[model samples]
Target chain A: MNTVDFLNSREDLLSPGISACQGCMAELSLRVILKVLGEKTVLVVPPGCMAGAAVGGWNKSLGTKIPAAMPQLGNSASMLAGIKAAYDLVDPDVHCLAYAGDGGTADIGLQALSAAAERRDNIIYVCNDNEAYMNTGFQKSGTTPHGARTSTTPVGSVGRGKVNFKKDVPMMMAMQNTAYVATLTPAYMNDFVEKVQKAATIKDGLVYLHVLNPCPTGWGTKPENSIAYARAAVQSRYFLLYEYRNYEFTVSAPTKNIREPKDVTEFLQKQKRFAHLDEQDYEEVRRVVNSRWENLKKLAGL
Target chain B: MENEYRVVYGDSGLYVLDTASWRTFRPVIDETKCVNCGTCLLYCPVCAVKKVDGRIQIDLSYCKGCGICRTECPKQAIMWVKEEE
Candidate 1:
């Protein structure tokens, strides 16, 4: 099969009228998912960056030729379930996909999500976690990690940004014992696409895809450096690639250890998220990162 | 199915789970509590739980029972029971 063509198909789904900022990781992820899903799928999205990126005001859609439903933020999962039920009753061939941001998936919309996943709804649910609520002017969301700055978490007089760690969402979803669950990053296209395509073909319950999308505008990094930051996050073991199936958890990709825990300064220096961090603050962040990495290794049984 | 697979994204390898090797999401179906509302069937993505031979029986092979069936079932006839190793 021609893989290049498979990747090329996404160009059509990505139209020019959307409001995605330059180098927006959320837009890149939308393109990736659309390319793999193609015309045979229906996308269900709730309000967030994706809603703005996919469909602008006045009943206009970005460029997706396929069918779409933009419901309230919390209803994407339930709507997807309803759509799948309708399709099964009639066509049974179309793919029903629910795409939501971290705030919608991990925080606000999690209840409906739990209901959908628990029912083993035949839908591909993708959580494009850009860390914080970038669309709402960089507010802290449940997915935002400790030490990151947001309007709500404002880099304070105390010199610390956020004080809480990001939720371990992928593992939490996998704990549901569903057939497929994976953590991915745009830097790893081949891996991400493979996971998405596999999920598309399965006629089972929910398939959870957690994509770590970096936000240049919110994080105070260069627009061009978003993908680079994404790669760094994975390499630093801040985010590891893995999949869980049939009660076995497998690290799908090996995170070659980067020596010395990569001075949080490497990441902090680029993003405004840690602009307030000083020597003492940077060291504390480093310690937390190291502890998390070691615990991750233990979880993967490596 | 092909024995050979291509590497996608960051790595390559397939971990297969065969029938005997499969892990069931073992469910407890309390027929006494069932109202026959069909909420479980409506929400079940795999259709693993059904009115087989006139009563609710779970097809353990396909039922991961993520518990939408249990949660949505108004009568709460279904409960996710863990499978023993």
Candidate 2:
């Protein structure tokens, strides 16, 4: 069956309805992850966009048909690791999922996540990265790209948005000796599904899937452009789709074929957060993205 | 089942639970043009796109009308009709 047919054949593990912003790729990606993981999975959504949107449940009714919990913001990965340890005592087949935002993953949760990865905790930790603390009004997070106008990184005569490049969380996780590390985007559902499926099979240690999602509400883009922006992010090499396992790296097919990356502006220009970027800033962003893309190609032995 | 989503989007212009009012341009699915690819259903964040009786339909009652389905439709099987007061 094709992608569409295959998707339709699977059961939606999430509830029938969720209140995430329209065209929210993070929410859509979460649904796909759960679909691939199936019913024998326990979901942990830290205090982030996914939880705030009620993916952790609102009342007596569970948000997901399966068991779910909303853990503290910074402890989702370690918490999921603990759940996995308990599951090992029981079924061991049950997957423990940590669905957290970039803020939770790269900021407050980094310590616990690093510790979990170091201990080789068996859990799948997915970082839904919209570049900042989006649900909390777009404050700057560790993963926020340089020159993006997050709420905390206000643009003005004095302030010119975030002054640092986006922290390469996937590479960091890979370096930490994770059993698996992959980059995901909602635009390529096939790639996303494949990575999530591969992650489900990893049992030896932590699996880190870092998704660069588009938040229209936070990025000040039209909601419909969420997927478009996600596509551009990869096409422009601002985000590369790749997976790391067994100490080897391979670029996903979609990203591997891009011989000439589209101009970085194609991705940055779509978001209001990057509106203040001058020509020089664009060049700088292009330089950083290209350098990172080249580094990945080397790692993949391209 | 709609009661499962009580989070209001007053920012979309009202304090209503029925979020159909939040749509600026309602998606009009052209069943005649549709090839049943299910692209709309897969990309829809709200799961508003559904297959009922083997026919694709948009659940406008819950659709926030982001127009992503229409934009993503390879066949252009969906149209965007501006919501009228």
For lDDT, the strongest prediction is 2
Error of 1 at A33 (Å): 1.0
Clashes in model 1: which pairs? A118-B66, A118-B68, A119-B68, A190-B8, A190-B9, A191-B8, A191-B9
Report backbone clashes per prediction.
Answer: 7, 0
lDDT per residue as tens, model 2, A88-151: 9999999999999999999999999999999999999999999999888989999999998988
DockQ of 1: 0.01
For every model in order, the TM-score on chain A comes to 0.91, 0.98
Write model 1 residue lDDT over A170-227, tens digit each, in one string: 8888888876888888766667778888888778788888999887778887654666
Candidate 2 lDDT at A224 equals 87
For each candidate, what TM-score against the reference? Answer: 0.72, 0.92
Clashing pairs in 2: none
